[model samples]
Target chain A: MKQARDSAPAERALFYTPESVAIDYERDLGDPGSYPHTRGTRPPNTRRETEGHDFLVRELSGEGPPSRSNEQFHYLLEHGATGLDVIGDTPTQCFMDPDHPYAQHAVGNQGVSICRGSDFVALYEGIPLDRVSCDHSLPGGFAAAGLFLAAETHGHLPELLRGSAILPPLFAEDTGYSSNLPIELHMRLATDSIEFCSERMPKFHAFVEDTYYISDGSVGIVDEMALGFVELREVVRRLVARGLDVDLFAPRIALLVNCRMDFFAEIAKIRASRRIYARMMRDEFGAKDPRSLAINVAAHTSGATMTSRQIGNNIARGAIQSVALYLAGVRAMEISAFDEAIRTPSREAHIVGLGTQHVVQLESGIADVSDPLGGSWYVESLTDEIETKITDRIAEIEALGDVVELAENGYFRAIFTEAMVDRSREVVDGTRPVVGVNINEIPPERDTLLRDLLENRIAPCYDRIEEIAAWRASRDMGPVVTALDNLERLCRDGSNIMPGIVEAMRSEASMGESIGVLRECYGRPYDPMGCVERPR
Target chain B: MTPTTRLRVLITVLGLDQHEAGALAVSRLLRDGGAEVIYAGRFQLPETIATTAIDEDVDVVGISAHSWEVLHYAEELALRLGQADPPIPIVVGGSVITAADQVEILSKGIDATVLPTAPEEEIIATFYRLAEARRPRL
Candidate 1:
């Protein structure tokens, strides 16, 4: 059988030698947690005191309404999940209410639908806010506002809150997966959350630069790192320009990267990413705090690599990717479920996915040491090569223009589209050997059982339109209107919109209504889909 | 269909599902196969898709349904497109699409369903065949 020996995406050298590496330990491999944290973020013995596991096994779990997803949260916790990663449904992520005309079909389809602060309250009904680390993967000011209001309702102060919020990326509008708010207004709203969290949420990560979107959009590993670092730098520049110290918000900044099938390259890319980030922070921003120099890297197994043809093969893929992530010394990890390529994972598949992490962490003993593959000749050489490639790629990306200009001019989209086409062509031409897809073949009828298992695992649909209507009827319109008016004024006056958003949520305003005000202030349609007109 | 007369196809994604790789890939494949591709991008409503197809006078409309939104909106989209004078043929494809989903969508009047693992040649051929079938009715 013919096989491609080159590393994917970047097509780096397949083999390396000591002469090729020539890595100086003192210069390249500093002690863990020291300046230029290339080996790992923390020392080997610096595991979390509470849990024996070295890394936090945070599984992505959210579907249906807040109440339903809340059950999954508790289920995951009971099953030994160290943290919670909550995802919002399409409607909620886009800041549209379930009642919106364009949002009806997608309500509660992909993730939990949280249309209001109360929904967040219900989502974490009995879960203690301060005790568990949550990744609020929803991007926007509304998600942060809802979460903040929920924490307050549960008697937790902003300072006591734990977890992270995914700030909206500049390429969000270009990708079409997130809100369609203009890039400038979107960044403004995101900056508001960063500012709010930097001041109050001491233990919370204000911005998690998720390169998973870029990689899953068919971008190469080198480009993914380049784009991620570029976006992170732009965010840092904006925050610093606001008169905030580099050390203040930089410590809270983190990355969520994708773990693809190229095991060694993925590991090298992650190691290089840490080194690049540390250098950028210390050299570029002049950060003094050690915490600001170290970056927290959370990885998710690439969902794009999961094949719909041979569903069970994805389990092995996830396990192998988990091992790569562990060897690379990721702080937190989430394995993609085998059924993810088909639909939202079933409970059985979700548990198995969680078990994959546990098996690797506890059973395999790979986590006993930090950066176990740190000094290997091949890994070190590849890491150096990747580091150089990513630096050059970043320079090329910077030369194109700023993040916002690249986003508006469709530069990222063009590259991603080209990559996607090339990938498909590779599969078609047999250059890429996807086991069940292009290489080893299987008849469709033979996989009926697997198909049944994945297809039958459909998330139950909740009538959120009626639920929102009833909740709206139960709330007072007076406070809601006042809060929305205040939020609009804050948007117009160039003030942080987080406080106003929190006020609206506290007043029981829906996310759509709150975002509608921001959209109107920014001169866009009240509805991102242009389905509804702004009220005069 | 004559070789000189290029087949026009509109590629789009409906609802809030933002995974556009499949849609974009199909657009590229169709364009490479000598079809006049009208890429509609994302965040499109079913009504808007039908209007775009009719307005562009495309023979076939390809939807990249990467989520269950297609299951919910397929009937409506098919109905809207069916109301056209020469109803457009709709093809849905995505990684998330299952054989059962293909059956369900086909039952809803979708003209064809292509799996993500389908060969580029087969996919291009399917779209061209759908376009050829629609031309005679036109």
Candidate 2:
């Protein structure tokens, strides 16, 4: 007989009853779409009736060239996917062009290689911008500039665009997402996009604080939500200080949360997040609009929990995690494919991942009602517990001084490193039961089928060096140089950099050139990696 | 052949693959296992990693890969490290690493590979064996 575990991953009590769980329905657990929305942000059945489905099924699809990613977007749309979650390759995310020395081997390994507005043009060639909701996973200012330019090229006004842009967090350097850029400049670029979009693009989410990477570092559920709120508060403070009304942009701000494998804990964390955001927005910021008080949550399944061993087990894990998201009332979600642990999803694996969402939406009956586990003693108790813990954790983080200072001083890295080591130790010692990794016993020789699957796995392969070179040569240098010079002027003068970025894109300046100019103005090397020097 | 010296190892992630949880954890694991770990951190190029390994006089180098960049950079990294006076062995590991990836890495002159699922004892033992093979015989 095996010994039973009694605590959740967050170290909270596993079981609850009315005696342990105290709830005042009128105050703590109000009706759906009500103030301080503990139940949900939307009215019951809003997803099924108002929204296209119970929830928008958006699978993250991006790999190789823009043309290939465009094909993937159409494929997902044709196969019941309601939205597109586009991600960029690592080099693009780091503001490196294909020809950079550091970007040589990593041109288009994981996600799509997008360097300029032209790449976005190829990415969304035939997909109408207004008809679909596309979420871009890229750095803030660059994503906005590229999309705006693409919309202009396609004759679609920016105001009519339906999508969201990721606002890179202050700790982007610590996370290694964009280490080549200085942190202050990164935040300025993020704010520039938010300020630009607040006046325009009402339909687009101007600021999406993605906590997926943070949580994936093995940070506990409580700290994940807490850190997310702290980052949100910081961004909100920056925008408000810029004299922008909270209502002007608050309604469009959102969070990209991570749905980990903890069934009840994940659900409770998300539900608690809604209540926290509602109270924080109303009480702290003095926001007047009801829409501004409610926080929009889009979730991505935790890729950290997926394992390379027993590859098929990930499908089961993904399905169970998706249930947690639906129960928590996520507006949109992307489930990780079964083979995501080994490589980027193959076409079949991507479709199977999409199929998982469809089955849950149509067959599971779990999405039929809103917050179906609302009044359950265990769930309600857990929600209250997580809510209080997250609030306390936020204060603890704030006590460490400014979030940017903490990030620059290596505070986030230290915590993340400790958390990661502790988690790895647990798995190594069998305290954490990862089925294929530590708990179950299987010899390598007997797992030949999985080996075969791994052997046939396809990674995106592309050589964008010559293509980008050709693109550069084809464009006239006169406007490009002028645009880059103007961008530098704006950077030095402390003006909003979005218009300059937009103008640079209009002149067909590549992302590397524009960012290189900004880098130079900031008194840093043109390439943070020290690979490329500015041309005379 | 039980030579007595604390083994020195260089741990790093090549290129823009920034998933550092595994790499950081392995650094701690090696340190705990009595090895002197020189953690090179993230975004390391092949030439830089090779120079650091030789500069630090490490017995073996470990590349913690969470993406397919390991496959693309493996040959070049092997070539760079091979030019040292006494070539340093390279070991690779990650959650994304599969048996096929291990075979591919081995063919590129990498000495060994460890999966995240490997027990701590197995991981430590593999690194020690690789380090021992690279040691100078008296």
Candidate 3:
């Protein structure tokens, strides 16, 4: 009933008949696996039919020490998870060692501590890298280097590795993640990793742009898809200019989309994003390969949609979003735990999220038919409308001169803030029904267990300071210094920083050190304790 | 506008915690409640925040902490603001903080600790209460 901010408000359509909307099956609703893939990417009635083979059930699992995360990985695997969405701790994401002054408090608090190549080795000690698809949230190519070094040490070839890097251009800059370096340097490092992956780890999806961090419920669903396309275009244009084939990277450019509680809108957004991406690749990028035309989507159940008032309601939200993604033919899916609004998901909450996906896939026969809502006139109309709105927004961004210039000038921030303020006001004023917040009012109760979890066991990795110190002391510093020197040199030479970072990782240089070398090369001050300043 | 309408509140994130949602929400609530709200945005050092508070001549400062670094940053902000003739009231909130953290933050002379999920009315009430309490001292 509600509309996204940018899109036209919900039309007062009492009934939808065939006369209301006309759809040309060939042009608008083409068959799956064909050009301008509107219905689905893969063919209908195949692995996607009845059997849930097409979609990888990825658990967004990780927390505390690498060993603890290792346990989570195994736990998910044991529970029939197809892929592992490895979440790096705040320190790791920020490229800080556990011993760094800023990192001492946050290590393993948000996710798993991954400051060194050894951490990756420990994270996947028994898990075969080649067999399982592992997605990481680490930016600035730190995870790529760490994984490379770990693979080499564990006698696994880089070519056989498969995974995705959540290296969105401004993930750290946009989100409050600690980005020690500026955005330009971060982009360079990310591109370097992508370039390396293109040549070496061909199966690995080098970039996953998650607009959720910036989405923040501020913009419409179409705005989210449009912004993602704008970013994809920018990145692909840069990569194409750098002499890389579009087909090489386009297939691996996965989108991590947030499926909020808007059921039909969320479903439409997913379908629209796929069609738009396909056409953009084929028409603009000259992508001849069908694989390049297709898009891999990892739908994450919206964390912003979860409420602290009625925590259990989040389970229903997660299930609904998962079903939407499944029906939309998303390649990978992650459901946020019910307790995420309060703290890092507890073990029970994590299991519930994983179980939600499993139940939706097995019990709900919705995925048995390809594009279950394909022939529905309402869905088809919504899909067309969403695609048009998103394309218009992308064009709007392009009209604003250089995308980089716009990014630097607080354009996106302004857009996000205005929309967010408007959304929040609507929620407060009862215009937007946010379930527990504005409607279905529940008298608040002091959940002591929730408080206890927050006060005590929420952040499960506090004793890592000593272990990190010990790790630092045991590792030889000479080779680490040498590797850093090489990294700095490579960075200064405007060369790909991947090789040097992998070499540094091999020498046991912590993630922070590798990033520090790049920071130095970029002529930026090295402040591991410093936070990235918000755009003015 | 009356003095109450002119009352200023600065919302900021402390330490390396980059979560801006809490700070932004608080800023919006305080502004909508008729107080002038100055958002310090993210990744601000304690000194920067304290100096900004002094420079802006704000009535109160709210720090959104979403990591363990809040413990470190809140204490640092207090120490910086304490040097002033009239130290500003600082409120901390986020999912990462706890009752123990609230106690520690208050012990450092922060004015209040509002949970992120606290009602908007409660948030607005806290702002006015702290602003009024600090008026005489200022």
Question: Which candidate ranks first by lDDT, i.e. highest?
Answer: 1
Calculate DockQ per candidate and list them.
0.70, 0.68, 0.43
Q: What would the per-residue lDDT of candidate 1 be over residues A59-157, giving only the tens digit for each residue? A: 898988888899999999999888899988888778788888878777786888888888888887888888888898785676667678788888888
Rank by DockQ, descending?
1, 2, 3
Q: Give, for candidate 3 chain A, the lowest lDDT window spanning 10 residues.
A: A527-536
Provide the lDDT at B27 for model 1: 86
Candidate 3 RMSD to the correct structure: 3.8
Would you list the rank order by lDDT, best first?
Answer: 1, 2, 3
Each candidate's fnat, listed in order, reads 0.83, 0.81, 0.34
For A123-199, candidate 3 gives per-residue lDDT tens digits of 88788899899888875587777777778778899998988888767434664365756667867877888898988
Score candidate 1 by DockQ. Answer: 0.70
Per-residue lDDT for A174 in model 3? 62
Indicate the docking level reached by candidate 2. medium
Off-target runs (Cα >4 Å) in candidate 2 are A1-14, A45-54, A448-451, A457-462, B1-4, B136-138
Q: How big is the positional error of residue A313 in model 1, measured in Å on the Cα after superposition?
A: 0.4
- lDDT per residue (tens digit) for residues B63-100 in model 2: 89887788888988999998886888888988778767
Write candidate 3's Cα lDDT for B24-60 as tens digits. Answer: 7678877777778888786677888888998887878
Candidate 2, DockQ to 2 decimals?
A: 0.68
| CA-lDDT, candidates in order | 0.82, 0.81, 0.76
